[model samples]
Target: MITLATSVFGIVLCKGEIIKTSVHGPTGKISYKDEGFGGMPVVFVHSFGGNVSHWDGIKDSLVQNRRVVRIELRGHGDSEFPKDGDYRISSMAKDLATVVNLLGLQRFVLVGHSMGGSVALQYAGENPSRVAGLVLVDSNGDPKKNPEEIRTQIKNVLFSDAYVETTETYWKQLLERSKPEVQERLFEELVRAPKDMVIKITSELLDYDPTLSLKRYVGPKLAIVTPENDDKFSLHRLQLGFPHKVIQNAGHWLQLDQPEAFREILETFLQRY
Candidate 1:
């Protein structure tokens, strides 16, 4: 696996590099990547079990005119994973706020995927004025989506020896099946994540409910749902309370599969806002 490092310049340097930086959260220090500082900062949050590299492809495009930041939330990626606590959505939301404060980011956009998407919603819900805009890509917001059977099944899959054996494929599921450009990077970051973080995050996801969070925010928020699911799921979620657009044919990892379309969506939203 490749170890990402940086010079004194930090993650948001003039050259394309992701510096290893750490910020203090309430519980502990959290690791993250920063790119293109000074302009409006765009903070990125990863899924249930994701590293900062998930946003690599879309980083440069966003960095051209804005500052891009990718945060490895507590218990995920290079961040500190404590052995106890609720690790609730609200707690993670506070962690995001701390990162923003540490970076002196007065206003910015928050884009999150899967679990990160839910965290973004919670953060927006708490601090509506601080958020410039919001983007939720294939995010899970309701606890009802996964029944007890599904949760236990996924928990078993994530913790089993088979998962460790087929870890490559497991991570690849988040990548687009059409484009095969990101193997090296994904392979490196996928295994770097701690297994306990994976399990606990799943546990938290199984109990998360962000409907109230979505309803609380009155800012520019876009939920990019996938078209792979049936019409019923899409209709139910869209009408649940937030406005969203569907990224056709793409699975949960819309950014990796359809970079251009995903970039288009972000640019349009940012421009409109």
Candidate 2:
């Protein structure tokens, strides 16, 4: 039931009757889907190597009672790649700012997954007054914890001729606990991302210091993660004292792996905060 039309600006889709639109961002056109019209707006930013469709599993339920906006990061989905090859997290955060500004969202809840969590933190840190609440899903807050040797190894692999194969293996390992169908779909999306873009983003991400941003935003915060990440260092472990919930039997993409449970946890946060 998906219909599409071109309007000289970008392709607009009529899936579920939601109007898919685009905004002119710092790097290029940024595509996002806006729906619903009640309650505080809920803005979603998908993970690196993912598009807006990554939120499809839970967006409809949230959209029923709240204005929901899902933004696609540059170089992903319909968004154009940066002409200058700027894939830094801060630049991506600016892309988020562009869309939010265009929508005139003065205040709203921000939700981010994986790399998107970093972008959300950056935005909330810089514009703390605008974000009412912040949620980080399976995202790391201190990538600098990784030793230099490990990062060097990762960079070498990313620049090697076997980059695609190596990344495929890494993605598969992350989805080992997910459903077969979920694994298949997500793997395809992750592996298809432009190699150079992925490399640059990953390289910069290793050096990203989310602590400063996390300290700046003093809003209600929550970290939703899977059991596999329970032992890992994260914002939830910081002195910030924000709560975190671990969904059992779920993989990296907990929202897609356990949509109902993920939504319940998310709704609880929205309600309590």
Candidate 3:
């Protein structure tokens, strides 16, 4: 297990070198780290407003026995935001393809958390043979309820003159349960993100409908969700013919709230598939 320290960000990237790779289609660069040597490669895609660091909690353990790849999508982390500002899930999925191709990956397990789950679902649906299985952590393929209030608030913050303040307030609410360091990291990244680009990507995701696409991926899948935060988009609601595991007493950031538990669950699920 390698530990890469970055002077630029003051963050310890575990398992491998922090590599920057260009992902075509979107015409932007993505930051990723690779670790491990054998077994089926396990690739991780983080959520919206997130980066490769999101997997810091479980990545070390995951990489012990299998090749692991974690990507920092465009507009987040060290990745370059697209000049054209194309951050759609489909676009991100294509970017993932670029990563896999660049790394010469064959069949592998795809794991995604939150918005990343949508990208994983889309990718798996389009490239079924390339994906050995899938794991969706605290994710929703198609939200049953439209979060109009959340949308309006985000739009207001993006367009309002008090953009920075309002955005900070909004982010604070989301990261309330995060560790202090994690919260700080997220705030810093969000502040540095191209707001207009982020808004465009988030707006598109809010309207995204992956209902049919998620169901069509006829491959092994494991859904892990926190019971407390599942009301909006519960694992029980996903009829993708997969086992759904519930982690109780946890919030939206399940991995942060219960890292060891989350890691164990994921490792066990991976072993099963």
lDDT of each structure? Answer: 0.73, 0.86, 0.75
Tens-digit lDDT track of model 2 for 1-273: 455545433445554555788877887888898888789899999998888888888888887888999999899899999988999999999999998997899999999999999999999999999999999999875767779899889999999998988888889988999988889899888888888888998888888888888789999898999877666467688655578999988879988899999999999888853
* Clash totals in order: 3, 0, 0
Per-model TM-score versus the true fold:
0.77, 0.93, 0.82
Evaluated at residue 179, the lDDT of candidate 1 is 51
Best by lDDT: 2
Error at 88, model 2, angstroms:
0.4
lDDT of 2 at 89: 90
lDDT of 1 by residue, 1-273 (tens): 234343421232334454567766778767887776555678999876677877888887877777888898887777777545547778888778888887788888899888788889899888888888888887765666658797778778877887676556767665654355555555566677666665666677777777676677778777787765324443226445556777775656778777788888877888854
Steric clash count of candidate 2: 0
| Evaluation by lDDT, superior candidate among 1 and 3 | 3
Clashing pairs in model 1, backbone N/Cα/C closer than 3 A:
11-34, 12-34, 12-35
Q: Find the 10 residues in a row with the least total lDDT in model 2.
A: 6-15
